[model samples]
Target: MLLMFLSRFRVLISGLSIALFIVLYGFFSMRYVPLSIPWLRLVDFSFWILSLGSCLAGFLDLYLFWRKSPLISTLLITIIGLSITFFARLLSVFYSLLMTSFSIQILGGSLIDKESFVITTGAVAGSFLILGSTSIHTIYKEPIIFLKSSTLYDLMNTLRNTPIVYGSVRELSNDYYIIH
Candidate 1:
């Protein structure tokens, strides 16, 4: 029931909400003295929207995975990486932290300008987009080949069918499976 509702209305709601945000952002950015809001506030709100959308998409991806559709995860992650490229243009705390942590300077000079930042962002995002996508495609194509379990193979034979997947674990040990 819930899935049906979501399937029918999700796209409509998402489109409307994004449109509403753009409209509100433009309205707030206008030079009208009485209605104007801070640019930083608008940016913060937009970031929150992106974060929330990514999280919800993650949850939906998990549900879809159980239904034997694992492709959504890769698509969502790629989209998220692309969004980060756009957001990196802003002078946000995350961008500052990355720049400071990595010591990214302009050709060994002190100043870091916009062009260098944009180039670095694009390079990193593009590399991940390419490599990450191929890896995800491989994993989805044949998950069990990587699991490497003869016992799992025997169990599948006993059941007379091979399951589509058995996902990764944190570590290969008895301790890793303990709840506490």
Candidate 2:
């Protein structure tokens, strides 16, 4: 159980770190130069798509997580929604930054020169797909893990010691013996 939590913790932190780095890179670069370069029009579209996807995915994730762990209903309803909103916005920025970088690489053009619109769009879109994929995968796993790892699983197991969580221990033991 501890190992499971630790692994989950690491993945969450790593994903968040990468997301933060991408967002920072985007904003910092924009500060020095305007975000809209003529070549990078695609980047804008990609960011928009990414933004939309994040919002949708976040809502879906929250709903599923709530269904799995109804105990955290209020927290999930309010805080989870906020968290999803923040992630969606952050993801769009990160996608833009990554796409911008990729576009520069593909063009084999001098990084010093600003790119045109199309290159930006492709790059931004690509970035969104990459980052969004990770988020989608994590969201898919969260509910399953939370539902299975709840105190209910532990309490269910403890019932084995009492012969109450399920039914009669003599019958259970006999069944187990017969199966073995």
What are the lDDT scores of the predictions, listed in order?
0.39, 0.40
Where is model 1 more than 4 Å wrong at Cα? 1-8, 32-37, 70-180
- 118 Cα displacement, candidate 1 (Å): 8.5
Q: Between which residue pairs do clashes occur in model 1?
A: none
Candidate 1: residue 161 Cα off by (Å)? 19
Candidate 2, poorest ten consecutive residues by summed lDDT = 171-180
lDDT per residue, candidate 2, 1-180, as tens digits? 554444344334334444654575466456545444532333343344443444444444344444344333232333344454455444434454575574543322212223333233343333343345335446565432323233323333444564443333333332232121
On a 0 to 1 TM-score scale, where does candidate 2 land against the true structure? 0.28
1-180 per-residue lDDT for model 1 (tens digits): 676445333333333434554565566557333222344344345434443343333333333333343333454454464455344433343454466675543222211434433333342343344235334534565212233333322333534542233463333343223121
Q: Report the CA-based lDDT of candidate 2 relative to the real structure.
A: 0.40
Model 2 bad stretches (over 4 Å): 1-36, 70-142, 146-180
